[model samples]
Target: MGDTPTTIWPLDDARPGEVVVIARWSPSAGKSETIAALLPELIQQSRAESGCLGYQAYRPDGADNGDLVLVERYADQSALDAHRNSVHFRTLVLERIVPLLADRHAVVTTVQ
Candidate 1:
């Protein structure tokens, strides 16, 4: 499969045919480890999705942290939506991660 060009929204500025999603997560007090253990599988699954160009998970640099930042890119809106509605999203993200999270925020942007 051909790779789609990817760029950081704040840097390269997004363009059409690209969809960017930024997700910030704050795991519940004392639950960072639990959440951390689960993210690898989730990230792997997400990166394997069709139209996915990039999927990265980040946390604070210095120490074991309670926060996570997810940066994702898809070929288009439909791909992002498909990801949102995927079973993993419903079961793992919504059911599991959502409860462990103290708060979560997501923002979507289109490059163009």
Candidate 2:
């Protein structure tokens, strides 16, 4: 395992009605395409959810851990919860995604 980048966003200084979710995923079986294919569905589901503020994905340059990051913001905790419980999330994780990932990390926080 490599040293994964630690990303901490200060919600205390964030704007009102903002929530944050950060995630990192590493590919298994040398297959990044599987992860990439699933992203659009994830983003669409997240963006369509009520109270979504913003959602984006990123890949770090020159990272050894095959790091892929997802950054998402919502209007509040309830919205974040809805995102977590969304069908698209469930389907992707259970049906299409988990088997392809070597590692995963996530942090969800509310803006103070």
Candidate 3:
């Protein structure tokens, strides 16, 4: 398997401290297992990071589409940036996740 290209998007006019990353994958070749396998590690890493307040992953109810949502809160933009650069995040995304996703989209957003 090889690394697949992933897109990262910053959500609608969000401020500096909070973020929500939405991930979408192809339906027939879903990424549920991959996300499940990686989520624990990702959560742990996020929690341990300097700026992470909370991080969670979810699958929308009644939705057959291969979509996953990650809700993340940080102390500030610096924390979120730190998460992006963290070893765990890098490893999870590049080594574990990229190979499994047929298509991926990430949107970073903040709460009002």
Question: Which pairs of residues collide in candidate 3?
Answer: 11-108
Clashes per candidate (backbone, < 3 Å): 5, 0, 1
lDDT of each: 0.80, 0.75, 0.64
lDDT of 2 by residue, 1-112 (tens): 1124564442334676588988888889667877787788778777888888777777877866557887788888888878778888788865677788888898887666
Write candidate 3's Cα lDDT for 1-112 as tens digits: 1113352332434565475555554423656666667778777877888777666666665756656666667767677788888888788877787777666677766665
- In model 2, what is the error at residue 2, expressed in angstroms? 23
Candidate achieving the largest lDDT: 1
* Cα distance off (Å), candidate 1, residue 110: 0.3
TM-score of predicted model 1? 0.82
Clashing pairs in 2: none
Give candidate 1's whole-model lDDT. 0.80
Candidate 3, lDDT over the whole model: 0.64
